[model samples]
Target: MNSKTKDAIQIILVILSILMLLYSIIYLVNYYSENDILTHFPSNKKSEDTDLLTPNEIGDSIGGVLNPIIGITGSILTFLAFYIQYKANKEQRKFFYIGLNNEKQNRIDESNKNIDLEKKHHITNLKIFKSLVSSMLNYYISSSQNIKDFLESEEAKPLGIHLFIFKTDSSYEYFNKLDFKNIYDSIVYSFQNKNEDWENDFIKILNILNFYEKLLAEMKNTYKIHSQSKAEKLNKVGESITQEIGYVLSDNELKNFDGIVEFLEIVYNSNPDNTPVLPEDQFKGTDFERLQDEFFNKYLEKLHMRYNETANEKYKSQLDKFSFMNKKIGVEKFQTVAYTKHLREVYENNFINQTNFDKVQEFLNKINIS
Candidate 1:
């Protein structure tokens, strides 16, 4: 039974015992008085009064009946005390068990937290190790003479014309001032003529590009695994590692590589004797029109910003290096059958920025077609 119920039962029993003791005493007193058993002893001795209880007899008679009731009441009180003690012990045991359970749960929770922390630390270490390895590989590749030369070459420096459009106005100016077409034609001629030195350098560049591509793919796989496993931190680490691997090639080199690959593909596959087609014949198309609209508008906007910013001292110093006096060449002269084909292919592959494409498109659009 519950503590309250047990306590109520004990209280009722105590009340009943008290009442029973009180009733027993009353019954004894009434019986003695009614029967003349407890009458005072007479000073005059009489034979008839011999049947009455004397003072000593009256005390003995009361003791005989009262002793058993007192003993019974004492026994009930002792049982009540033991019952209360038993209930107290039971409550203590229950409290102890509850405390023990709480402690066990706390230990389990602490262990789980430690395991999770260790797992995060391990993931962090792995990310660091992978990033270091990628950096080392990038350093090794970039340190090579062939790759270094390719990156530093004037052919690699023209960000414009490589991806059908220039990313910045400075690149277009560089292209015009450097007479990039002649340099490009010379490289193409070397490939067409099968120059061994140029071919070997090309092969080395391709190999390096391939290596970076593979590394990026591996990093992407790692990212996918972490994402699927629901490890958000690990996924972010993978993304960081992939980005690090991607930076193996600089923006300029990447653009140059695209142009080189396109040039190489044409030289190796096209008819060697094929005459270069006119710009109007090669560049006109619905797709080219769309590309022009998308790229040229944004380019013009940025070009306007660049013109306005030219008053800045830092910009003016940079602009002073390139002479703006040279007569600008017609886009038709450079937009040959091969170059047009390369542009279209690059556009289709999404290698060129559509907005930056507009920059070149706007410049080309403003040129007098003659």
Candidate 2:
């Protein structure tokens, strides 16, 4: 039964016991009086002898009334003692209940305190994770400025001399006359060599590797997480870092960066759940193929979203051709030539207005994916 019910029953029993005890005391007192145990001071004395009155006898009779009063007062005092004991027991029971409730409340407060502490821990972890990701991306991009310029330059285009070196082009007079192979090789060597400007970038990469090593060890040792949501955010940071690592590794100039790809793969393979949402191998690209699919996908997704509402058939056709060339070009060729050609055609045909073309071009340049 519940505590309340048990307490009520105990109280009823105590009251009943007190009433029965009082009733029994009163019954015994009446029985003793009826038996006349105090009928005479001496049991052998008779009523006739006591009938003769004297001055001393009259004084004794007056004093006898006080005897009954004293007996009644004694009985009242005995009942009062029992009532006081019952009250004391009731107070003790109340104290016990209060203590029990306080104990429960204390436990609840302790649990809430633990939850708050854990929440703070998760928040701190998320902040650190975010900082690491931003720092890594910033450092890697800064270090890759030379490679970015190479990719965006006009000389890197499909028909440019730099690309034609690998193609079966008959017009090779400029290259033979200038001995451009040694010149280009020297340029590539200088770009790959670490200068003072790249010192901080190398440090950042090392720090990123160290952080991942520690994080992996921690996850292996501990099964508990303060917050699953924060853990998921950490995974996103990992993915971003992975993409930056791929971008650096894919560059022809930076391809010789030692062990970076392997280190990233180790961390990524260790936690499959946190790996980048890229194709089978992100860094396995040829020529001007961009390994950073995240940027391209972001632009493509936005493109579809923006045009889906307008139901623009020309834009749809262009998006389809881009998709087809993406697969055909694989990792060896740049899509800029084909993509720019298609945009030019669309503009000349007035398929898209000037505002839409400007918007699309701005987005392409913003993401550096065009």
Model 1 C-alpha lDDT per residue in residues 233-285, reported as the tens digit of each score: 32333344235324422334222322223222222221224443334445321
Candidate 2 has which clashing residue pairs, if any? Answer: none
lDDT of each: 0.43, 0.42
- TM-score: model 1 vs. ground truth: 0.33
Clashing pairs in 1: 295-358, 296-358, 299-359
Cα lDDT tens digits, model 2, 1-370, are 5657656755665565566556656654553354344352324444553433443553465346444554555565565567567766877988999999999889999999996775555444434433443443333333234323433452244322221011122222222243334433332333343333433443444354444334333422331231232234334444554555465456553333333344444444322245653555663322222322432344345446646967776446534644443444332234345533543443334322334233333322322100
Off-target runs (Cα >4 Å) in candidate 1 are 24-52, 123-370
User: How far in Å is the alpha carbon of 329 misplaced in model 1?
Assistant: 30
Clashes of 1: 3
Best by TM-score: 1
Native-to-model Cα distance after best TM-score fit, residue 350 in candidate 1, in Å: 26
Provide TM-scores for the models: 0.33, 0.27
